[model samples]
Target: MQVLRWDGGGPMLATRDSSTLTVLIGTFAVLWLLWAIKKQRKAAVHPLPPGPRGLPIVGYLPFVGTELHTKFHQLCGIYGPIYKVWLGNKLSIVISSPSLVKEVVRDQDAIFSNRDTNIVGRTITYGGADIALSLNCPNWKMLRKIFVREMLSPTNLDITLALRREEVRKTIRNVYDKKGTHIDLGDLAFITVMNAIMNMLWGGTLRGEEGAKFGAEFKHIFAELVMILGKPNVSDLFPALARFDLQGIRRKAKRISETIDRVLDYAIDKQIKSLAKAKEEGTTKTEQKDFLQVLLELSEQDDGAPSMIMTQIKALVFLS
Candidate 1:
């Protein structure tokens, strides 16, 4: 039968290829197992806090519920105040003890100053360009100095007090006019605080009418942004799959970021044009300079102080 058959060696080639592939796969799996064992041994040398074991690949992701705080509390009860949780491939350590928290926040603050910003957070914050999300470095220190020493100085806060008062009064009047109607106090408080912040940022340039219109639009955008930020993202849990963006969180964040950038650009352009016109007319400016103006002027300074770029300015404006 074998002598009678001549199939051009097709079966033989297929068998050889299959054998080769099997060998390669077997080799890879053995190597992986050895690597895992080595890692476990190394970890044993400096053992981590005890916690529940998880399944392969997915880890404990499947077991976690939507009410994460409650789950964390239960885990704390079982594993003491500090324990590690494997959320997908990421290792998150829970710190529930008050003394441990104080030690991290006060005694070891500098060691833990850098933050691990998620994918969506980084996209919206211009790749961690702002002080809030950026890595702790010289640039971060510089931004903090600008924010605390310059923008939030006692004198600057005093000057912006009128802006805050105006917003509070406006909120109170609005509430009075809508007396007995259903009103969400949370939303009301957020709007009041946001409006005050907006005024303090650019009230010197934007007229009252313009500010009112812009504030409404900005509030809606800001609410959407907060909602997006609060949602748990799969990409954040498994960073290797971030490029795929299975949940589309990154796309939504990018769209919101673009909208905010456009708004900031409009305001910046208007301010630049107004400043130019003032210079051309030789008019003495009498209005209090807003945070935007101060940041711009500082950017132009040739002094030894660490200054900001346009990208940094926009990033700070959005987060501020």
Candidate 2:
């Protein structure tokens, strides 16, 4: 008889639960409405540049194919001379016209002087310690001043004249020796320039038989580095997934950086030993100063100017 009688409180309990659920649903809707209203108000206050709406997460990244320049040109036609493109979470404004380019680079240079560095660029430049990829700041300004006023000054260039001439003569001789064989002018030119740069940097050169072997290795590594840098990296587009490095660009960059770092370290060690030997022999005054020497001296200085670190020196030397 007790089981046959239904519990009337069961219905009441069910009704109470339904009512609680209703209240929660209404609260959620109210909160969502408030958020949407706030977002709309903010957008109204400062509207962004007109651009195509993208997908939820990937944005326009997928649509931009290998021919980025062509795709950008097409987008320019559709969106006007200047428009925004959402590459994942990052927003980039494309200024296709020359006038705007000049305005951004020349007229408002300081305002837009800072560069947006990617993962590969940061790695290659040793966390933007080099001038080319560094942010526009006091350290960058000091580095620029040193690079322009001291390192690449007419006096410094004149001092390195003999080094440059020696490399050029060696290159000419190498070309003459290889006249019978099929010549790659590009490789020759690259090696010549690299040798000249090394001479100016630390009074070294990648010439002769041993030097040719090293030069070839360097060329291959540099080409690989350049290819990786130019590739479309998912990590660059989606910063949240950067740690995952879906494309392995970061890993490649790190390996290349290590190889370059070793070469730089070897050169630096040799330079330091030479400098020390000169000082000990009382021939420091007679030793012709190279860019490395100048940078090393600057590193030792306690002048008001921002002091250069080993990383910066290496970055500058590598970049040069």
**Candidate that would win on TM-score:** 1
The lDDT values for all models are 0.84, 0.82
Using all chains and alpha carbons, the TM-scores for the candidates as numbered come to 0.82, 0.82
Off by over 4 Å in 2: 1-45, 204-216, 285-288
Tens-digit lDDT string for candidate 2 (106-195): 999999988778999999889999999888888889899989988999988887888789889989999888888999889789889887
The TM-score of candidate 2 is: 0.82
lDDT of 1 by residue, 1-320 (tens): 12233488743224556668999999999999999999999988967797878888778888888999999999999999999989888988889999999988889988887778887779878899998988879999999998998789887787777778888999999999999899999989988888989998887767689877777778888889888899988888888999899988889999988988888888888888877788799984545667887777678789987779888888887789
Task: Please give the RMSD to the true structure for each candidate, in Å.
Answer: 7.2, 5.3
lDDT of 1: 0.84
Q: Give the TM-score of candidate 1.
A: 0.82
